[model samples]
Target: MQPPDLLFLGFFAFCAGLIDSVVGGGGLIQIPALFNALPNALPATIFGTNKIAAISGTLSAAWSYVRRVKLPWALIIPAMLAAFVMSFTGAAIVSLIPKSIMQPVVFVLLIVMAIYTFHKKEFGLLHTHLVVGRREKLLGVLSGGAIGLYDGVFGPGTGSFLIFLFIRLFSFDFLHASAASKLVNVATNAAALLYFVPTGHVLWQIALIMAVCNIMGSLTGTRLALKHGAGFVRVLFLVLLIGLIGKMGWGMLR
Candidate 1:
C-alpha cells in the first residue's frame, strides 16, 4: 500500500481502538476501513489483518482495566477460556456458511439489544451481582462460547454483544462489563488469529503499524472510561449500538 493509504488506515485503527476500548464496536470502524483501504486484497486476508490489529488494542485495554478495575475474575476467567476454545472452532467453520444469512440475524439482534437497553433506563448504571457460584459460571461459559463462535464467524459487534451479555446476565454495570468484555475479546481474537496466521492470511507489515496506533487509542479510551465511570460508558454503548445498527442494516439492505 502507499503511504497515504497506510496513514488513513492507521488513523481509522486509532479511532476504532479508542471506541472499542470504551464500548466494544471497534470492528464497526476498523473492518470497513480495511476493506476500503485494501480493496484488492483477499477478504480473509483483510479479516486476518484486522484481527491482528484489533488484538493489540484489546490486550492493552484489558491490561489497563485489570490494573484499575476490580473485575470478577472467578466468573470472567472461565468465560475467557470458553471463548478462546470456541473462537477457534468458529474460525475453522467460518468459510462453510454464507455470511448473507448471518448478517440479517445479527442486525435484528442488535436492534433488539439497543431497544431493550434504552427502555430499561437504569439497566447498567449500578453494579448488582445477581448470579453467583455455579450458575454464574455456567452463564459465563454459555455467553463466552456462543459469542466467541459469532466473533470467529462474523465479527462486527462481538465486543458490544459481550458487554451487554455481561451486564444482563451478571448484573454488572457498564464499566465493569466493558472491562470484562475486553478480556474475553482478547481471547477470541487470539483464537481467530491462530487459524488465520497458519493459513497465511495476515498482512503483518500493515497490521504492525495499525497495532501501534490501536494501542495508543486504547490507552486513551481506557483512561477516559475509567475517569467517567459506568454512566458514561452506558451512554457511549447506546451511541455505538445505534451506529452498529445503521451499519448492519445498510449491509443487509445492500
Candidate 2:
C-alpha cells in the first residue's frame, strides 16, 4: 500500500476505535475504509485484517472500561462464551451467505433502533440490575449468539446491537451496557480470528498500523465516555445508528 493509503486507513481506524469504544459500530467506519483502500483484496483478507485491528482496539477499550467501571460479570461471562462459540460457527459458514441479503436486514434494524432510541428519551439513562435467573441468562445467551453470528458474517454494527440489547434486556445504563458489550465483542472478534488466522487471510503489516491508531482512539473514547457519563454515550449511540443506517441504505440503493 502507498503512504497515502496507510494514512487514510489509520485515520479511519482511529475514528472507528473512538466510536466503537463508546457504542459498537466501529466496523461501519473501519470496514468500508478497508474495502476502499484495498479494493482488489479478497473480502476474507480484508475482514481478517480488520479483526486484528478491531480486537486490539476493543481489548484496549475493554481494559480501560474495566479499570474505571464495574461490570456485571455474571451476565457477561455467559454471553461471551455464547458469542465465542457462535461467532466461530458463523465464520465457518460466512461463505454460504450472500452480503446482499444481510444488507437490507441490517439497514431496517438500524432504522428501528434509531427510532426507538430517539423516541425513548430515558432509554438508557438509569441502570437497573436484573435479578440473575434462568430467563435473564437465556436472554443473554440468545442475544450474544445471534449478534455474534452476525458479527462473524457481516460485522458492521455488532457493537451497537450488543449495547442496545444490554440496555433494553438487562436494564443496564448506557455506560454499563457499553462496557458489557466490549467483553462480548472481544469474544466474537477472537472467535473470528480463530477462523481467519488459521486460514492465512490476515494482512499483518496493514493491520498492525491500524491497530496502533485504533488503540489510541479507543483509549481516548473510553476516557470521554467515562467522564461524560451515560447521556453522552446515548447520544453518540444514536448518531452512530443514524450513520449506519445512511451508509447501509446508500449501499443498498446503489
Candidate 3:
C-alpha cells in the first residue's frame, strides 16, 4: 500500500480504537475501512490484518480497565476461557456459514436492545452486587461462548453485545460492563488470530502501523471512560447500538 493509503487506514484504526474502547462496536468502523482501503486483498487477509490492530487496542484498553474498574473475576475468568474456545471454533467454521444469514438477526437484535435501553432510563447506571454461584458462572460461560462464536464468524458489534449482556445478566453498570467486555474481547480476538496467523492471512506492515494508531486511540478512550463514569458510557452505548443497527440493516438490505 502507498503512504496515503496507510494514512487513511491509520485514521480509521484510531477511530475504531477510540469508539471500541468505550463501547465495543469498533469493528463496525475498522472492518469496513479495511475492505474499502484494501479492495484488492483477500477477505481473509483483511480480517486477519484487522485482528492484529484490534487485539492490540483491546489489550491496551483491557489493561487500563483492569487497573481502574472492579471486575468480577469469578464471572470473567470462565467467560474468557469459554470465549477463547468458542471463538476458535467459530473461526474454524466461519467459511461454512453465509454472512447473509446472520445480518438480519443481528439487525433485529440491535433494534430490540436499543429500544429497551432507551426506555429504561436507569439501566446500566449503577452496579448491582454480584452473587457468584454455579448458575451465575454457567450463565457467564454461556454468554461468552455465544458472543465469542458470533465474533469469530461475523464480528461487527461484539463489544456492544458483551456490554449489554454484562449489564442485563449481571446487573453491571456501563463502566464496569465496558471494562469486563474488553477482557473477553481480548480472548475472542486472540482466538481468531490463532487461525488467521497460521493461515498466513495477515498483512503485517499495514497491521503494525494500524496497531500503533489503535493503541493511541484506545488509551485516550479508556481515560475518558474512567473519568466520566457510567452515565457517559450509557449514552455512548445507545449511540453505538444505533450505528450497529444501521450498519446491519443496510447490509441486510443490500
Give the Cα error of residue 141 in candidate 1, in Å.
0.6
Per-residue alpha-carbon lDDT of candidate 2 for residues 174-199, written as tens digits (9 for 90 to 100)? 99999999999999999989988999
Which window of ten consecutive residues has the lowest lDDT sum in model 2?
67-76
In model 3, the clashing pairs are none
Q: How does each model score on lDDT?
A: 0.92, 0.92, 0.93
Runs of candidate 1 with Cα error greater than 4 angstroms are 129-131
Q: 2 or 3: which has the higher lDDT?
A: 3
- Model 1, 129-227: lDDT tens digits are 654699899989999999989988888889999999988988899999999999999999999888889999999999999999999999999999999
Candidate 3 regions with alpha-carbon error over 4 angstroms:
none
True-structure RMSD, every candidate: 1.3, 1.3, 1.0
Name the better of 1 and 2 by TM-score: 1
Global Cα lDDT for candidate 2: 0.92
Candidate number with the higher lDDT (1 or 3): 3
Report the CA-based lDDT of candidate 3 relative to the real structure: 0.93
